[model samples]
Target: MDQERIASAITRVRETLAEHAAEMRYRDSEAIATIEAGLRVKVNGPHGASIVTDMPNGVGGEGSAPSPGWILRSAVASCVATLIAMRAAEEGVDLPGLEVMVDSESDDRGLLGIGAVPAGPLSMRVIVRAQGTSDDARAREIIAWGKAHCPVCDAVERAVPVQLTIELPGS
Candidate 1:
């Protein structure tokens, strides 16, 4: 990790925020996905990274890659881990090892239109394991701060309005 570069970037971000007040620049991210094979999708991001998503064989898919729910969990876990590490670094905490685990349970009956259950996960859990921290109080503080500061964690905890539009050919 390039500490100097990270410090410089953080400084630049602070300066930008200070200059812009509440009118900060917006960062936009987009992903494109194309249907691969049965219940599989190939998603391509702007960073030249691609991932294959598929459903389990029970759900009429070959179970090639991870499901969308798993991907969401992975995103939450990875974002929390990164935010914790970055915050620890900023606070001069020497963390040798950090692990984050995220889990959620969903009722698929709603998706399958079999029952009146919710289509999303019922609940989510996030667990963090950190090494090289002696003070349990400080470690708890850091973990709490990380949870509050992580954007993904915030999004997951709150309900954000989403507008969906569908376009079909010849329609």
Candidate 2:
């Protein structure tokens, strides 16, 4: 990991936000998606990037690409992994091997409309594997700090307001 670069970047952002108080309120990203084919969608990410998402054969999709739920889980796992690396860098700790895994439990009855259960995941588990020399306590501290500071982790764990507007061709 590039500790110096991460530390420098964090310092720059902190200083910038401190000076520009108005700019400190919002730090956000966006993704847009449109239905492509049966149970398939084309998503546009930041900077003109793109990805395809499709449901499994059970859901009438061609199984061409990963499902959206899988994508969400992957994002959670990767985001936490990144947080760990950033934290390590900031703390000047060296971690040779780091692995993070995320799992979520949900009830299909919610989606199938067979029950009143929520469609969202009912629970989530995060597994982290890494070791840094300083001390076991220090390593735990870093990992906890990373997870606690992770934006995705926080979003999933807490409730955030979503403002959405849908436009139709003929209304």
Candidate 3:
């Protein structure tokens, strides 16, 4: 990891926030996906990155990539890990090995239309591990701070309103 670059980026963000308190609100970003084949989609990220998602063979898909639920869980884990690193850097703590694992129980009954279960994960668990000079108490404090400050963690823990609209070709 490039500690210098990470520190510089964090410093820049802090400076920007201090300078533009009222104008720092970020606009909504979006990820676009298009159907490729049966139960398969090609997702395009804001950057040049792209990924493919497909269902399991049992679900009548080719199982090319991971399912959406797995992707969501991975996103949560990655976000937490990044936030932890950033927080540690800000606090002058060296975390040479930081890892985050996110586990969730997914209920597919709603998707299958076999039951009335929720369409999302039933529950989630997050585990963070890192090696640092700070004591256990300070480590706990950092984890707590990350949980409270991480946007993805907050979104997962809270209820977010989602509005879906469908557009048909030629009206």
Candidate 4:
């Protein structure tokens, strides 16, 4: 979207969050993904939205969809792009050709249970390109601020706690 439209959307989002501060801040949400027998995973969200993920055929998967890691990369890239657009809009900078690329670096042996490597990506690189604007400095400022403010990026960078539970069929 153009600067004006983006600004309007950002304002709406901010207002909504502020107006529903309590509910928005502490909403109970969970991602549900189910796999029947193989590596294919189906994730369902509200409003009937869904996503399917799979590993490659070589790894005993259907290979019909993107892998889970691909989804993670997409989430990070898209979130950064959205925040950048919002910041640019706030500053009235037009970015008609904004683009973002996310590169996830992982060790194959990690997931394969080799050595002591981690199962997640060791590092990630984000490339942001802005076009249709000659304000290079302002564009850089927006990109920097937006990238810094991305929640997904922060989550990936920082350590977060996770709990595991095993459910049996009957008892």
lDDT, each prediction: 0.83, 0.85, 0.83, 0.88
Relative to the true structure, candidate 1 reaches a TM of 0.90
Error of 2 at 26 (Å): 2.9
> Looking at candidate 1, what is the lDDT of residue 151?
87
Native-to-model Cα distance after best TM-score fit, residue 58 in candidate 4, in Å: 2.5
**Local accuracy of candidate 3 as per-residue lDDT tens digits, 1-171:** 566678789999899999999998886667899999999999987768787899999989999999888888888898888887778777776766778889988778978877788788889999988775557787777777876788887888899987889899997
Model 1 stretches astray by more than 4 angstroms: 1-5, 22-27
Clashing pairs in 3: none
> TM-scores across all candidates?
0.90, 0.91, 0.89, 0.87
Ranking by TM-score: 2, 1, 3, 4
Task: Give the CA lDDT, 0 to 100, for residue 124 in model 1.
Answer: 93
Worst 10 residues of 2 by lDDT: 130-139
Better of 2 and 3 by TM-score: 2
Please give, for residues 106-127, the per-residue lDDT of candidate 4 as tens digits.
9878999999999999999999
lDDT tens per residue, model 2, 1-171:
379999789888879988998866765677888999888999997888998999889858999999888888888889888988888888888766789999999887787777789888889999999754657777788888889988888988999898878889995
On the 0 to 100 scale, the lDDT of residue 144 in model 2 is 89
RMSD of each: 1.8, 1.7, 1.9, 2.2
- For candidate 1, the per-residue lDDT at 127 reads 93
144 Cα displacement, candidate 1 (Å): 1.2
Best by lDDT: 4
Superposed model 4: Cα runs more than 4 Å off: 12-24
